[model samples]
Target: VMRANYRKILVPITEEAKKLKIFKGEPLDLNEVSNLNTIVEIRKLIKNNQAKIEYLVENKAKKKQAAIYLLTKTKVEYQEILKGLRKTAKKQQALLDNIVKKYHEYPKFGSKIVSELDVSSSVLRTAVKKGWLVKKEQEIYRDPLKDFESRKQKNQIKLNSEQTHALNSIGKSIQKKEAKTFLLEGITGSGKTEVYLHAISIALEQKRNALMLVPEISLTPQMVKQVKERFGDNVAVLHSGLSEGEKYDEWRRIRRGEAQVVVGARSAIFAPLKNIGLIVIDEEHESSYKQNDTPRYHARDVALLRSKFHKCPVVLGSATPSLASRARAQKGRYELLLLTKRANQKSLPKVDLIDLKTVEFTGAQFDLSIPLVDAIKEKIAKKEQVILLLNRRGFASFMLCRNCGFVLKCPNCDISLTLHKDTQQMQCHYCGHKEPIPRKCPKCQSEKIRFLGTGTQKVQEELEKLLPEAKILRMDVDTTRRKGSYKKILDGFGDHKADILLGTQMIAKGLDFPNVTLVGVINADTALSLPDFNSAEKTFDLLTQVSGRAGRAEKTGRVMIQTYNP
Candidate 1:
């Protein structure tokens, strides 16, 4: 399973070689010699019978060589940390609370948090003196959920009959301590998340941990909140948005068994959690679960492996299961549980597709059709909101010189640089290379350069022009680049602060806002044009997910999908 093997060449100092000052080899740590080329050379020598170096698989903590070390509160140090509890100054107490929170969050390293706590060194010094916190020279785990406020104990929610049945099936596997795979296929708004939460409760009740994998960045915060709210501070979240310190602490929490529940993105499947009672891959159909890089491994596949190793239950839950998983469930390899109806008994939204070839354009922009504009205006008039998904960001997909027909492209990558109006730069979506937007073509020096191809930013601009009174909140990679921007934008829309919410694919899934009565897909053909075989499946999933976000409350939802191909 190892991708590369590194070995250190060590030779005892010999009088002849030492006196000559030409030693053949020196004592070195194995980790310090991580060169693949050196390993290949040694392998060749061994194959030729020219060398007889022994291979040793050293079993140690995976992160012992890491730069930061964890400082944990000793068992008897709890009271010491809380010394002079009431008499402590308000500011000092707050800083102390922060330190205590970190202690509970994970084995927080002494070096990372002390300087940043906005407290004097004496506070940390006092804790050390009282044996309240001990600095140990060991690698620490990164915790992304470190900043999450610790919550009070929450009561377990009651499950409906369907959720009970699913939990019962999962519970049986946990009770038997046998490896089993389950496919929990449910429609949108079917309370699949409820089933997952209850199953996790069962796993923890049995004194075993659980690992849950979400699909994308959009799902992480929403799901993490739910899991954390249910499991309290014992839950660790792993995702890409987390800073290095946060990730390290969360990882260490799982590794050391400090965290009982793990909720994260695709890479969370590899968390060093032992004796896991349950593994869940939420939104199992998402392509994001499949790693696109080397040592490529699907989260589903890894879940199955860990389930087998730990003799636990692995649940794959999705409104639309992938074809491969559905086939497996069909063949009885995985036990399938179905939730066909909405948990709230609300009717599904009405879906209407606008054919661009036949529909009349609303304005000179030629992007938002007349019917879509009218729908948005109607929603705004009713005090409801709208979500517009363009599946593309930036002001335009490319810049073209009208005179010479020269197109602007990224020098480092083959893809064209997207014109970002907000940043006033031509940015490469793939490589992140950016330069000032060009007025004249770099190649032909043509003055008439045109921004071609519509994007979320362009659609947002058009919406503002068409509906001048509508308040719009744009959520995309460009708009929500900051750490907490996703939640901020979603919260604003939910609070009726924004009448129109527009964005790329990130806004398409796992968003629930009842006031969002109308969902307009400015262009639905983006994913369909991909060369991938499952492009249709992806497009279908996206449209279905985004459409589901409309009118989830008492109001009936309406979706208008604008497509060129019908």
Candidate 2:
């Protein structure tokens, strides 16, 4: 008697939206956003006599669960698909529109007893369901769940409604894109990584391989750790950091199908992984993606083209996503998923810029901003680590003739020669031209000479004089040119063995440190004041990233940026 009021209904949703979200035997709005029009359409279908909910089911066998909500019942079947399924299934079916749905999970099997006089009952009773029961079990197909680690592996990911919808839709569109290209542009700290991981899992389940790329080597270890932790041994690492033999072995493993996924810096785009189903690029807008050497190519652009060649999709992730990616998403060239929240217990650091223009440090032979010195001392007293970021290296920028005001210049190139007090030599940073310290100026033979401008080495020396007990480590090509020197330096700072970490542009990408509370920008103006169009952007990203290093976990953190322009 209650089934009489359960008149069948149908709802309207975008065809594209429907094609990706719905699954077989799945309720309407399964993965789609519910709307007023959808509700009204369903309600109208329930109110009309022309609509029959039972006819919505293509097969009477699968319609047994249709009894829960009559309003959502429709004459349409779930046409969305997963990999290797038809690109899109748009054929309409409203014949079994009278059926209602069942809300209970794991319904009990019932006998086919129905009253002969009831038309609907008689129709359902004679449908003769033929599937879902095991007829002949095969022993070879049976296996213990403990045999595979994946069977016991935990599902750590918790997706929001939008992410769930995206997964369902993306699964359905895989087979449809034999000729189509798709991109995912998500913002900073956004769970963009999870989305890509979800997609990669699907690709692997389909017996295909995947690829991922990041911009900087500094960020690779963190990513590699995450991927390896998630995917296990099936993952391989590749990048300039690896030995040639190691890279070649990884490439071979990729081509032979031994490794299903490879993650690395820009060059990994050419990893030669076959049957590629997905490609993910983290920090897609980074300039590091562009190859500066000959046969130059942009990693992101190349990844897109490679994905096209393989008929796969690309997932591009960034906290501060690049303008190009944003533009593509705006133009509908890529699907945009916004994960505005940080992954775990983390927060963006507070940035405090100390203007150096007004601070008087000129009392000495050469001036260092007083606010910066104070901040350093304050951080030291508080027992929190500090990082002094500068973009230049060398003891001093140049040597000068105080008597004649003549500056020393490089002989080979028309550039100033930097003074290296540690070695008592004047060297051209560009051409490597070096000469012993002269008693008199080369030009006017004046004996009065002064070293001009501070560099990384000078900063290290000054900090020693100011904070004698502080452990200082400098990281740059100059100090880390040896094989494992970079790793040694990073280890020292990472373990809190070093109280102060100072360097050129090497340490700014995304070094996660928990104890770093004070990030001091020795000279923010160095990069911004450089003669380059992208200087501002590079400086901004670097500054923001460095500041992020402070106060990452629980303990409060602050940043002191001392710049001439503040």
Q: TM-score for every candidate vs. truth?
A: 0.77, 0.65
Query: lDDT, candidate 2, residue 173?
Result: 53
Tens-digit lDDT track for model 2 on 1-566? Answer: 00222323333343433343322333453224377765565555447542223423222111113221112212133221112233332111111221212212212222221221223433333232311111221212111111123325666878776566656656655545442334444323335667777888988888878898877665666666567768877888777766444555566667778789898888889887888888888766578899888989998878878877888777776655666677877798777766544454356566777777676552352435777677777878887888878778888887789888888887789888887777788888887899997778888998888887878888888878877898899986678766446556776787789889998767775566667887878788888877877788778777766776677666767777878775
Residue 450 lDDT in model 1?
Answer: 89
Error of 2 at 284 (Å): 2.3
Output the TM-score of candidate 1: 0.77
- Candidate 1 at residue 529, lDDT? 100
Instruction: Please list the residue runs of candidate 1 whose C-alpha ends up more than 4 Å from where it truly belongs after superposition.
Output: 1-143, 146-157
Superposed by TM-score, candidate 2 places the C-alpha of residue 36 at a distance from the truth, in angstroms, of 94
Give the per-residue Cα lDDT of candidate 2 at 308: 79
Which ten residues in a row are the worst by lDDT in model 1? 14-23
Q: In angstroms, give how far residue 35 of model 2 lies from its true place.
A: 89
